[model samples]
Target chain A: MQIVFLLEQVVNGLVLGGYYLLIALGLSLIFSVGGIVNLSHGAFYALGAYVFVQLSGTLGFTAAVAVSPIVVALLGILFERFILRRFYNEDPILSLLVTFGLALVAEQAIRMIWGAAPLPATLPSEIRGSVIVGNMLFSKYRLLMLLVIAVALGGIWLLLNRTSFGRVVRAGIQDPDMVAALGIRLQPYLTTVVMLGVGLAALGGAMFAPITTVHPAMGSEILTIAFVVVIIGGLGSFWGVVLAAVLVGVTRGVTIYFAPAASEASMYVLMFLVLLLRPRGLLGESIAKFES
Target chain B: MKTYQTSRLAGQKSVLTRRTALKLAGGTFAASTLGAPALVRAQTGPIRIGHLTPMTGFLGTLGGWAVEGAQLAAKEINAAGGAAGRQIELMSEDSINPENGATKAQRMLERDGVDFLLGEISSATSLAISEVAARNEKLFVAVGPRSDVLRGERCSRYMFCTDIPNTAMVNAVGTSLKQDGMVDGKKFFTLTADYVFGHDLLAAAKSFFDANNAELIGDELIATDVTDFSPFILKVRQANPDVVCLNLAGNQVTNFVKQYAEFGLPYPMVGFNLNTADAWAAGVGNLSGTWPTVWLDSVETPESQAFVERFKAEYGKIPENHAWISYIAVQIVAKAIEETGSAATPELIDYLESGAKFDIMKARQAYFRPEDHQLIQEAYAFTVKDEGTYDDVYSMLQLDGAVPAPDAPLESIYPSVEGGACKF
Candidate 1:
């Protein structure tokens, strides 16, 4: 194969990796701090995408992208405060079941509102083209999306590493009781984290609206892949999640290049291998944490 | 509860008003002048056509489009003085799940009291509903599902397909490839979605390849909803097939095509029944130059040209072959009702079986073969073109007749009318 073709595949892989990163990061954040596996994360993603589509026709694409995530984030906050908070002291399995129920509810709500047909979301005219990098051509919108995700990842890293709130969050992840004894309000922080995580998922969904058709079931479809990435990368490890996302994306892209038939099964095989070797995943610390 | 009752009451009032207006416009109706005896004997009730489709769920989008097409046809017929002086009243219910299809058909038949039913985009749902229709002795016009078994082992005298069968579509593509010498000495690799429809399509294509002296190199059956197809792509590349046939639908086809292009596979890929204009547009720039077998396109006939113009004017999109079949289904039912002079289920079935000519897209005068209830028409072969806009994604290339109905012997494929049990 030509080097140019290889470069093109790499570009495609990075673009896909950007989406994986967004989903996996949200999943990691929810699991690490909240001690809850939000199986409904994908539903929120789908809702965000549909909301973006609904608003775009009236508010324009940029305004819809800006506002839809906030609306979805607020819904996430309401979910945490009213429903998820009740399960905080309960078994984690109960939380999983509750979230699974929530996902079903969200899916039905989407179907009732938007019906079953995949609604088309038009790419903004400004970003609708391809760019040549050396001898390979890459979609302009995809490359821009990669750049956007990089900036967002950097911002998230800084948030977790620099701020006082970040320190509190990190402390809570390590020991929630100790953080609570230190006089920090754990409930509010947990709620905020849930909202933030769901907001990130919604943002990813909104961004992806133009790339793929916005359908109700799309969230659940992508959720499975996100879980695979999280499992392989090491749950609750942000940097490890990023690495795993890229690994999965590049592996998928390269396999697509070589054997189109086996591409769909590659990520699962990688996840299985990782689980076989490192039971806690590649960067999972030796802690008795709940599984996603 | 009060609001629901009020809305239902309002719906009843509208129906009453429409009937009253029709009676007034057409002089003293025979039912009013000649009494209840004449009304009962003459079969003067409005023709109730049932539409059972998935108004919600994954396949709902196509269902919505199918409904719209049927409604548009009903509107045209009603506006032009109705069929046989009886207005068409459509009764629609959701058939998203398998069990729901049978239940919905029961509701349409028993409660709604429909004369004939039209529906079902998915093969599984179609089969399920077919049993209900058969049990109730109702004529069914299938609009979208293209499984060969619908007209083959599972065939019912009451079930007539508006959609082209999978075997016929594959035969069209296979015949074109043979004529072009593209199938000669090529190693074929098939990657198909693991489902009834996908497996059936792959089987038909394999049979075609065998007949054409082509070698089957490799095959894989991936699960439906498989997100990442990179590993499968790698396997196909290693197999080094000259021709790759994809038997997938909707978003899966889009993803597969994009991945294939990224892989830079030197061999040309031929898709079976992926030639619809809607799918090509949805795949965007990813599907340029990919040839797929189809039954109709804009370049085929004057009727097709008219359909393209009218459909574009109406829906702001080019009507795919699926849409065309839906459009034709409505027309066929209306014409049959007109010919029989009554909308009774038995009469309508008889009229359909009497071999009435239908003005479909490409075929000048396509008619249902009396023995099998399959529409006999010419098929079109098309290639996807990157015209930079969604409206002009596919360009048609005329090919020789692939399988004319007279030669194919559809009657041999269909089950015997007397003892065949409907298969789900």
Candidate 2:
């Protein structure tokens, strides 16, 4: 009932929201440009976490964090080249099924390698303690996580808005054929976009490793939450994801404080309300024009 | 007259040959009898014990520990020349899921040809494999699936459980709560995980509470994979019960305890047998002063001490109840094999059914009661004390008495099972 306690819960909610956004952003990018629901996005996230742990244990956490995204991006390229390339002209459901199967294979492969036990990942010594804000204390790592996510979001925003590559990506999202007619190779651009999306997912996984136990099935668990976030934010809108992430985060935090029993149900309720109000989502374009 | 006399003489000659042959056979048989014991010994071969464990799934860590305990037991038994002068060989396979469990059981039965089947951590998986044992007529010694169904309804004449059932621990905690007057007209709030094991424990605890005049105020069942428990805690605060009973295990318990403290609920929390020493050492500090029912604690006896010392020396950590239960399970199997003088499944079942008393770490003479095939042993009422400089959490109380096994009575508690559905 106390304001301070409520504020602390809200802070906790923001940290969770940050994770949702990290996952949702990648999903949104793939959906808008690649026109596919990559269910295996979560698999990439899991790969990122596992790779982070393996590399961090040897190369240290800092170095692994720096290099893991690039490594994951390369994997993304391979995946797009060998798998997604064939599905470009296939039915959307076909792509979804492919990703779903890929998710299962990835989960089983991870299980075969790492077994099923959760590997504990601790925050570095410098950031492990709590920071007092008024009467409430929040984990310093959470605060740092929020800051890192903000920076990443800002950098992504700039990448989408300011660069020539951003214009080409936006064009591809609108119409891949027109972009191809403009003499830009569509395959390489799609591959780059896929790499960026997967890299972001990997980055999110790596950052999340210290707080949560890293395990093979963690990706599937988080993937469901990410889908909820994406649906609430709008299918493939960049700003919509950011705004929806924060909204969902705050809602979850406040709900937990007031009525903890309804926390999980609250997100579903929000998504339902959003669909009822705007079928295409809060910031997504109306579907009537696209249908024609 | 000459022809008839010649025929009689031939018949007499044949009779004499038959008698000589009988005498020669008797002398040869007497000589071969002296060598029969050695030939029998050579034919019996080493006792092969099959362990089906979950080595790659959600419960894999616990399964790994169970495998370790079984391996240790086999090593010790083999070093002592095994049961009845035969070496022990353990053949293990991964039972990753319920279907996998049945497959693994079949493999152990038809392919590997093991003398006995051991290891099951999940109750549902155990129930699945119990059918395999029932059909195949293999003696299945369950290690840690504490569901009463394994012994009550799904009980096979060939199946014997080594771990304490949920009802035993629930009753132990329930009785302890009654003694402390904690259940006298107190409102009870339950936040149980939604599963068979969780529901069974909650149902048993509720019956005990109701019998002791406790009021059931509120109850909620959360999904097993729900990470955020704040909503449930908020509901608990709103319901405002005097006592809250948690029926969660493993990481869920740890997460619940941490979140409960954060939510600042004022009710005294009591967990029904799900809390263990390893869980406490991991992160039950948030519930520092709470009491939970336990089977084995380190402060109990010299046997427990020696087991803990040996486990720590080998694995570089204290053995939790999972490891201890698993260790005891293997020992019980070995004891049955030794007593029966044969590793045959039928003979092993007979040995277990004989109701012979055996020494475990806590009990002086623990034995499986034939009526239900439940282990009749002492139960512990453990209170989690502050982290010791040396010991992780000191036990505040130890209760020693014969707690009735799971099949004592289900008529008043679970009507569906008691209504001839789960009859032995």
Candidate 3:
């Protein structure tokens, strides 16, 4: 009801959107280049959080945050090279099933290592308080997360638009066969894209670790929302994922403000409306275009 | 089986136990499962106890611990020569949800021919299994899920809950809140888990609010599977209540509390249904506020000390509340069998109804209330430690320092059950 209340929600919404965007982009990227939708992307995220907790004991929080996601990204690369790579040329449904199975395996694996109970992720002393902006207050840690994620996403945008590898990835997403036919060794580049995408998911997990705590099912928990982001953002559209994740997160935040009961449903409602109006998502081209 | 009736106290929400849907479903399922008489009618045959717990889901690990406790108890019971002068056989099946619990319970009853059922932590799962218990005319000692409806609205003669029910858990906190000057006339907001348990917890909190004339600033039902609490926490900030009543459940509670601190909310955390496992899950410095616990590893009672030591010796760690409930559940059921000199469902029910008190590894003697079958025992109000351990749980809070909660006399902890939904 108050202006400050609305302002706070909006700010929190943006921060959450950035958080979700970090995870969604990776899911979208894997789908675009590898022709595989890695449901285990969330597993990568969970692994990242656990890795940070495990490594932080020895490596310290700062170093753990940097190293954890890379470990998960490498884990992702291993899956892609040996397991997921086998499904790239197969049916998309098969890829979905395989990744889903992998998600289960990853969840159980985390459970085995970390135990079933949720483990707390300690807040680094750096971002433990709230900062005032204008008349409203917001979580400083979330704001920090937003800033870091924005930088990462911005760099991703540059890599996609301003770099040579980005061009090939775009082309591969658009036409993997044609890109492969161009004699431009697409396999290694695709692997890089998968690592990039999976790495970001791990980074999102690491960034959120302090807030959400480390748990085995957390990856699956966020994966559902990421899938929503992927579908709503347009599977292969880079900017589409970014904008849509923010939209979903913001809408959810704002919905909670107005109608707490419907907050969970608000994101899906947005997705439904988007699909009704723009079948390929807010900025995604077309499903047929990607398939061909 | 006896049914319980409870009325309001100090303007609190009366925890109506009538779960009509579950009662009907259970009643019908019980009817369908009747007439399976593959039992080895010999009194000396191995007594089978089927454990329907959340074996493979979010609560899977706790479920595993629950079954482990049962195994330990069964081992001890058999070592002393099984209940009713027979060996005890333990069988476990995953009871992730009500539907699964019902189906698996049927499997245990029909195929496995379990003489007794030790069931679920989730209220819904318990309700589902209760239905099968009623249908099959079997005795089920419900250990998890703290829904009072088990003895109230959908009271079944076949089910006896061993753990603290939601009302008692809430009332323990409510009693403290009223005393600590947090409830009366204070504005509060609630973020409850979206399920029967959450609704029940909210009703309990509302009772405290009503008694003390507190204003409910706002309340929200969070879905069971939802991990994100920012949206709800943001709303809590906007409401600016004096306290945030966390009626959330399981891992969601951990997620919500950690995020609450991360966001740096200043409101004092209070309200009902906080558990030891949830606290351990959050780890050090993450847990704030005092909570009501049915069992703690730090209990100084000789019985509790011995149980803790033995449990640790056997399981390599301290037992969380669920694990405690599971172990004691077997002891209670086995003791009933010992007292009645039979493992027959009706006889055990009758013996428990007769106020057959059992030692629950606590200072107090727990007995099933004839009306609701809710075990009557002393529940503790516990504060978290920066670091501690009991059994396998490395981060449990200190038990030596626990404040015996409700600080009210034992009788006031629960008012006499009358006019409740249960009609047996």
Best by lDDT: 3
Q: TM-score, chain B only, every model?
A: 0.79, 0.80, 0.86
Error of 1 at A33 (Å): 4.1
Assess every candidate by TM-score. Answer: 0.71, 0.70, 0.90
Those runs of model 3 whose alpha carbons end farther than 4 Å from true positions after fitting are A287-292, B1-38, B41-44, B56-61, B385-409
Q: Report lDDT (CA) for all predictions.
A: 0.72, 0.71, 0.78
Give every candidate's TM-score on chain A: 0.96, 0.95, 0.96
Question: DockQ (Cα-based) per candidate?
Answer: 0.11, 0.06, 0.40
> Candidate 1: where is the Cα deviation over 4 Å?
A1-21, A31-40, A47-158, A161-163, A172-196, A199-216, A224-292, B1-45, B55-58, B275-278, B290-302, B308-314, B386-424
TM-score of 3: 0.90
Which pairs of residues clash in candidate 2, taking residues 3 or more apart in a chain or in different chains?
A260-B230, A260-B231, A260-B232, A261-B231, A261-B232
**CAPRI class assigned to model 3:** acceptable
Report the lDDT of model 2 for residue A134: 75
Interface RMSD of 2: 13.8
Greater-lDDT candidate between 2 and 3: 3
lDDT of 2 by residue, B286-340 (tens): 4533343335555457888888788878776666666777778888888877877
The residue-by-residue lDDT of candidate 2 on A34-77, one tens digit each, is: 77889999998988888887788789878887678789989999
